[model samples]
Target: MKAMLPESVRATGADILLGNTYHLMLRPTAERIARLGGLHGFMNWDRPILTDSGGFQVMSLADLRKLTEEGVSFKSHIDGSKHMLSPERSMEIQRLLGSDIVMCFDECPALPAERAQIAESMRLSMRWAQRSRDAFGDRPGHALFGIQQGGLEQDLRAESAEALRGIGFDGYAIGGLAVGEGQEAMFGCLDYAPDQLPSDKPRYLMGVGKPDDIVGAVKRGVDMMDCVLPSRSGRTGQAWTRRGPVAIKNARHADDPRPLDETCTCPACTGYSRAYLHHVFRAGEMISGMLLTWHNLHYFQELMSGMRAAIASGTFEAWEAEFHAQRALGDIERV
Candidate 1:
């Protein structure tokens, strides 16, 4: 919704929205949003909204951030204002934002770290998870989710999951992956991580990825995922389609009159041609981003719908085979 209209996002069949607690809290202030009737009212989005607990942003984006047993203290990137985000504070912020699904405040360490570091971070996050749960208290409608943060260590992951389960939550998120971890490493972890959590509750893979990554995560038992790739790529003149990723700014599209994808029914494909898209992108028109973003989100939702149907019908193996085969064909042969 930040890059495009909520109506446009809804048109793409996105049932839920993810809001950044760090951004909203720092800029607009969570208190201000509460007066404006929370994020759903402020953003005019009535659907489910999941708000991360601001742990990742503070750890990665904040200037001169310091991590401690209590919480993280840092200067905001926006104004360099001093702030602290403990588990209790994170819970309070999410409540003020009126988030339907809230993630526990948990530390996510960078990958390629020593096992000891990973273990230490995971233990700290587990403690924070319990604190987050306690602070969240009894919100009747809002659901708090516990985040698992064990980096890539299987034993640590199991331990983290066990901790979260003991504390209890509405859902479980597999965090600490996708933080500089390559697909192979991530996939290796996913092979067992999802299973470690309870099968009854929702299993979310946070900050997950492209089309193939989504497919792989789903196949490995992930129930939900969220990413900025589609919208981000859209703004950068890229589009994701059934065939594969398409660079819309390429000169090859200067004269071609084909749609980004012949099979796509998005506004970008059905109503505009590659030449037009390329022209708008090169011309630096704002509609360029909107069109591509709409197309990418549409394609992603379609892919998920396809997978859901295939899974229901017990034909996922065949569906997966065909999905790869389609991408292998690449974009249409030279316009």
Candidate 2:
């Protein structure tokens, strides 16, 4: 994945990529990576990398995890080794990794919980945000971003945003949605959630979704987002295009001579046909993943570039209309 950075990512105009604090800490250990000259040297990619604070992973991936006022303690899923992640520790780890963008350590409560429970969780996250800020101190070029967490409650979201603003951060992330909240409910929260943050700073939507989800979020004023959808979906034989998803594993593509998308200039579309992609995917060839992942990443960057250009030229609405209209066409009517 790191090897693909130059052509597949940077060439396509993506300047930043997200790194998982939890997974990195577990595998090579922060100390090892730092000893080897930090993440850039370790990964051989000099671009900006945003590191999450490990709070969400502790809640989701760790085994026998225990949350407390100070932090959380858990056993690693890789091994039964014990570990702890507090706001201070999280800050230290990101600093050790030499991340360009460090996220504040904050609790993310799963949705469908009672309003009272969500409120309590959001309040706790606010306190942690302050601690994260304090622990982060002053890094010359590096930035620390605060996270706003409040289920779907508008009042709670406003309150959380106020708390983050009071503490102050280089950027703000709207968290706690996309856990299980459907797109409509998530968009409803976004309607007011992003507006609550400082408009001057970048507004990042964490774990935000598909092409449509990204389009909607950008339209609603979110400046940054991160998700595993494109890469993961590509590995699973799913391709995202202007016309929507195309499942390459489906029988319909087995003998199709056309490219995945006629307008796409990526290697997948330019060098291979739908039939070749389907054959390789069905045969479990590794290139199947590489080509598809490249195409997906290229497509996402194209989408971002289009949005940025549209917004700069004061024609975002027209660009967005075309985006949806293309999707409405629906994958070239099944080949």
Candidate 3:
């Protein structure tokens, strides 16, 4: 797991780490990880880690699972073996993994769904939230987060938020968004969604987005968010830079001698030329993914750092304007 992001590299920029409960629960298994001292020990990451409830897998891997009020019955994608993931089971798995932040098990209905369908899914999730709470019990250093799932319905969002508040959790997550909902719609929901939750608690927007999406969510009061875009794109030879995404495999970069981004301080940018990165990726070298992934991660960290500074200085708007303006300029032309 740390092959792409070693703790040493990730820690230098990341404030925290996120783990996939679904995958870990399936492979290596939660019991094995627990015996080995949990995810932090197994992964060699000392920083805080947040693990999802396996609810996303219920939605994403719908074809491989059956949904019911009790829980999801999944046929292992790896070996076709059967496994059940209920609220109680999810809580137990997170506990075994020793996650600092655990998410409540909740069904995430895909977007463009009927309001009736969304309502049904949300209510079920609320029920599971209670079960998750009871199963988690009281753990001193651990925190359980309740997820609000109502699709794009304002009233349902409010209802879901209130239900979570009634249950009371260490934190709250705005789930069921960014699941094929356009950015405009996601932002529309966030505009009122975060306000619906406890102001003092952290508001996590689940499975969110590109650079612009991150900025927009932060602007709308989303306390935190998660996405796989940076690393995923990096693996495909794309680089997320201040100026926008750079396709490192492009022929133009094959002979270019410039840094991916002149201003970038990442090792890939500082220590290698565009030509070298281009060559490795084209040659199918493993380091191609490693270097670009590190660069992309570094750029994302820098983006957040800039936003935090701008927010503190009351210059967020100015910083945002510059961000868009720089991206609009596009990748530097051969000059």
Candidate 4:
């Protein structure tokens, strides 16, 4: 996977990639990765890499995570080993990984919780953000981003944004959304969230969504976003395009000889047919994942590029109109 990523990203024109702190720590540990020359060398990808603080995984992936004033204590899902992740420790881990962009350690409360509960969690995350800033100290050319958490409350989001601004950071991330909040509610929060952060710094929407979600967020002034949908869906026989998602594993594609997307230049779409892709996926061939993943990433990057160009040319509204128009046409009829 690592060997193919660099080439795939290059083809997609992606400038950065995100690495999961929790998963990497569970496998190789931060110290071990540092001894082996950090994640850049380990992954063999020299491009900029952003590492999350593992706080989210501590809440979601760990077996019995206990949150406290300092941090969270939990057991590894992989080996059942106990571990603790504090703001300082999270900073240290990202540093050891030699990440270009490091995220602040912030607690994320699941949605549908009481507003009071979310407020308390947001306050705790703010305190941890200060600690993370102190521990990160000075790292030339490296960035530390503060995550704004407030569940769905606008006032609390403003408060969190103010706290992050007071602590100062190279960038700001809108966290705690997309945890189950549907796109409508997420967009409602985003309508005001991005404006709360400093206009000079980049605003990132964390764990954001599908093609439409990205377009909506970008329209709201979010400068960055990260999601596993493209790659994950690709591995599951899904393909995203201008017209919508294509379920390549369906029987309708069994005898289809067309490419996944005629407009896509990726290998899966340009060098192979839908029938061939369907056969490989049904056979559980590893190449199916590789090809589909490549295509998905390529399409996402193309979408991003189109958005960027549209924004620069001051034609984003028209571009978005056309985007929706195309999707309204739906996927091509099954051959």
- Backbone clashes in model 2, listed as residue pairs: none
lDDT, each prediction = 0.93, 0.91, 0.91, 0.91
TM-score of each: 0.98, 0.97, 0.98, 0.98
What tens-digit string does per-residue lDDT give for candidate 1 at 1-335? 54688988998899999999989889799999999899999999989999999999888953479889999999988777999999999999999999999999999888889999999999999999999999999999889999988888999999999999999999999999898989999999999999999999999999999999999999999999999998999999999988899998888888888899988889899999999999999999999999999999999999999999999999999999999999999887572
What pairs collide in candidate 4? none
Q: What TM-score number comes out for model 1?
A: 0.98
The collision pairs in model 3 are: none
Scored by TM-score, the top model is 1
Question: By the TM-score metric, which is better: model 1 or model 2?
Answer: 1
Q: Write the per-residue lDDT of candidate 2 for residues 1-335, one digit (tens) a residue.
A: 53265546666667887889999999999989999999988986788999999988898853479989999999998888999899999999999999999999999988888999999999999999999999999899999999998899999999999999999999999999899989999999999999999999999999988999999999898999999888898899999999999999999898899989999999899999999999999999989998898888889989989999999999999999999999999987442
lDDT of 2: 0.91
* Model 2 Cα RMSD, 1 decimal: 1.4
Q: For residues 1-335, could you state the per-residue lDDT of candidate 3 as single tens digits?
A: 33265664664488688899999998999999999999999988888999999889866887899899999998988999999999999999999999999999999998989999999999999999999999999999999999999999999999999999999999999999988889999999999999999999999999987999999999999888898887888789999988889999999998888999989888899999999999999999998988898888889889999999999999999999999999999998677
Please rank every candidate by lDDT, starting with the best.
Answer: 1, 4, 3, 2
Cα lDDT of model 1 overall? 0.93
Instruction: Tell me the tens digit of each residue's lDDT in model 4 across 1-335.
Output: 33256866676788888989988888888889999999989987888999999999898953488888989999888878989899999999999999999999999988888999999999999999999999999999999999999999999999999999999999999999999979999999999999999999999999988999999999999999999988898789899988999988899889988998888898889899999999999999988888888888889999999999999999999999999999999988763
